[model samples]
Target chain A: MKKFLSLHSLLSLICLLLVANNIKYLFVFIMSRQKVLNEVYYEPGYQFHTFLPHLKGVEKAGYITDLSVNRESNDGAYLQAQYYLAPTILELEDINYPYFIIDSKNTDFIIRTIKETKARRLANNEYGQALMKRPAP
Target chain B: MITIGYFLSFLLGRLTLDRCLKENVRLLHPCAAALLALVSGLGLSALLTFLTFVVLDSFHRPVIILVNISAIIIFLFFNRNLYIQKTIIPITDWLPWTKFRWFHFLYILLGVFIVGVAYVIALTHPYGEWDAWAIWNLKTRFLIVSDSWNLIFTDLHYHTHPDYPLLLPFINTWIYCFSADNLHPIPMVTNIIFVIGCGGFLCCTLYQIRKFSFPFLMGLIMFTTPSYLYLGTFQYADSLIAFFLLINLYFITMFQKTKDASWLNILGLSLGLTAFVKNEGLLMALILMFVVSVYILIDKNNRVGKSAVKHLLFTFLITFIPVLIFKVFIAPPNDDILPNINTSNFTAERFQILYNAVITEIFHEKWCYMWIVVLALLISRIWRAFNRENIILSIFFIIYSSAIVCIYVLNGKADLSWWLETSLSRILFSLLPALVFFGVHLHYSKQRGAHV
Candidate 1:
């Protein structure tokens, strides 16, 4: 009993229990193929990758989205878009720029934003995301 | 190619440490030295990369590689004597393992299991959590792809925390200097190394001081914490801060024991690196410097002389040069923090909210009762908690925690609960390993002879 209660034994027991607890989560994490969590947030960015060629030499572009800016719910998609299309700064809601990246689920909202900003849709990935160009005035 | 870059960096670090220590029998332990080399090498590489950017106005990959290779050649030549002398005995020689214990096997198995879990997580979340893409890796992308890397500090990228230090991104940028493309795996791999490095370093340092059982236990305790592994793989700078903090604490403990000026110099360098990891690290470096300076001055045993203190401060300032240049010249003013500072929010109610949030986090399930164990240990030995050996750490925790609280309390921007919810866990997470080390050291110091 004394041996069992020794510092080594007690610490070992705690560690054993902790490891056992962690194994349960490990199995769950593996089986779930938790890559989906990343894919959900990253899909919009991945879709934007095809538009990178169109954005060449374009140093900065305005970003238009139906999602609320600066909110937590909107940050992931917005930031991911900004990350995927880098060296090309995505100025949120500033349509004064000559180029724009449209990320919105609503078809009307995308068309309206492009039309309102006097920009024409130049390229897009079919999942309701696109790149728009504004001709010189 | 990235692997080759990382290896060269590691070699650079090992050779640098070997040259600096120079066959100091009491100071060099193979495992501890190896761990220190990995971090220091990577950090030095990052600093060199930053300097290259400053000089060339771009991240010229070939030049970066050539520079690192040149530095490595210089270190190799200087460290040749170390190779010839055959110093650095194997860690097993210091251990008392005449016969294999079942406990040793169990510990090894646990270590392997933890590392496997970390790798699995890293592979799944290759881009890492939101901040990695938003802030850290985002900066790395700019550092690589942008014609003007200075643009990252402009108001345009404020959401990306432009004011934050650039050590992690610079390290990733250094790795990318080897590859033609910015691979997703680079940051993921880098973070995993830090995670494993922290655990390995903690285990080795403890083993070097108080061998075998307690060291393994501390390693297991660290590995078992779910958040430590999860946040580590998230590719954030918190893990880097934790690693540097552990290094600082280890060297501080060593300096306290041996009064070796070399250890004090290493502590200064480590603390300087800590400041480069994040703003919190800068705060920590200040607090640690103040506490350690006070300890040195008031030490009952007048072993540490003024010359030793000068060495410590000198090394700290020298390593801190890059951080100074980056902060003053490159990075823009912090929008979220410094510019928005206000004392109007420091009400009794705000303090109450902050207090509740901290207490809740202390008992959060993510910690796996580790904090509870620390609390229990403290309560059990309240008297010895502030002994000469432990008081520096005790003071650091108090002052640092209070400073963090003041940041939250005084800041007018960002909702109080929202800020705490987003950040408090990570702030605590960064300190968790060092906190555990202190707890174990305190317990063992009281129970046994003061080896730690």
Candidate 2:
């Protein structure tokens, strides 16, 4: 009768795991007046990206949550970024790029994350990535 | 894990290459087979590790919660097992790439020409739907040799969903790695290949189904399809997704009646590739898996039942682990509004009220007649599936199209009207090519016109 809940079974499982893992999804909500004892935070502040359609870069902003990259060389190890004025994640693209730069604060952090790119950056393609990890050119 | 991924992608590539060879045996050489195998295999495996949060911030997380569980369900439903290494789909696999006719070369050139010219324009115009420049290709450059997975959060907090599951970036990385350089627009070239591959594959599919004329028509339609062409020029996940979809659908069709184990591997392989390309792809793939599983369940021999569980588990663990690790454990939820959540300042009741309004006002709006018309036509075909054409068309019509609509409905994005105007059609666009190809082939059996 369950039919294993379709492909989303793992999604629901992952959702359950998210609660277990202390992560959050946009879909979690107060089902009733009684508040649960504990809940993961699905950043309540993030709004629907207004420019998502026009942006044409991804399905949604902030869909990704972390990034880690490492390059073998020093000259290639620089990164370029453009943070937004309001800083809600969605506006990363709108920020003056070629206008900003961002890099990991520590080289150790860089070494540990060598070749690891954020899931979000991977989807957006090469030029779209704002934050970066690199090797010396 | 890297080696396994490479082995799988390479095998899959070999299968695809072999299929290509069989289609034009006269044009292929044996060495070409090895080359294609090498490219495809290495391309796919590297694709997996490269997707490690490089594309989606919560890659490991969403995949676990979303894709893995779905894969499990699919595996359970379509439970069948055989040694995949032993069997092959000759028509769709075992192709000799080394031999080919001059015409095959000519056609490949034609495809290159079309994609090349379009890409040249994109280079100067930079006239992209911001998503392409902002989300996919631009992001690809950043992720190529990334060392920090956390930096993605600082920039794109919660505007777009960047969790598509395609391997285009890795493909580009492969090229970039080969050149030992990171140049602007390098990713653009990969995007071009993705588009051209889709066009060429579509043409080949039509040729297989109906003959040269239908392929010609389908090729023209794809080459000229408006939003698709532009989407192709810049680095977006759609073209890659489309490519995977095409191959997946073809293999599914090939595997269904024949019961070739290789087809199942291709199915799993494609599903993996699709999930890699776009987050939405997993949903569609899961739905199709359900359909396939149902079909498998009714098999008289009960052939698929025994092995389904193991494959299902492996698939889930393989696909979902990365996403789960990312979203739940490492980064957790720092941003984004979910559908059910009361993100609005308004009370919780507002969601229902809003949901009702969106459903009634936006989804049911009058201007969205195209989808309705298309849906009706597809249904008509399904209702009349008495012959070979009828059955095939019916499956693609009802199953494939419905799967997409179902996902779009379930995962309703904000700005429903705009989605309908700009994006829904593209969602529909993914299935349209397959459906239209089916329609044309079916129609030609009884009619007198040359579609190509």
Worst 10 residues of 2 chain A by lDDT: A21-30
lDDT top scorer: 1
List, residue by residue over B1-452, the lDDT tens digit for candidate 2. Answer: 22333344445555444443233322223333343354445445444445545456422423422432343344333322211333432433345354467677876676565565555444533423445544454444444433444544434433334443335544544444334343344555556656666666666655544343423444444454433455566466666666666655655555543444445654664565566555556555666566555555555554556465344335534544554454454433522224533333344443454445434532342312323433443454553454542353355446655544443344333443444444543454455455545544444444443321
Candidate 2 lDDT for residue B46: 40
Please write out the lDDT profile of model 1 over residues B1-452, one tens digit for every residue.
Answer: 78888888888877766555554533645556677888988988988888899898876989998999999999777756666665552323223366456876865686687788889777767788878888998889888988988878873456788899989998999998777764577998899989888877887666655565555566666765666788789899998999999888877876776677777777787788888989989888989998888788778684767667787788888679889998898887677777677888779999999999989998987666767766775676567668887888888888988888888999877788888888888888788779777877776665444446
Clashing pairs in model 1? none
Poorest lDDT segment (10 consecutive residues) of candidate 1 chain A: A35-44
Candidate 1 residue spans exceeding 4 A from truth: A1-12, A23-44, A71-73, A105-112, B24-29, B85-110, B208-215, B446-451
Model 1 preserves the real interface contacts to a fraction of 0.42
DockQ of each: 0.47, 0.04
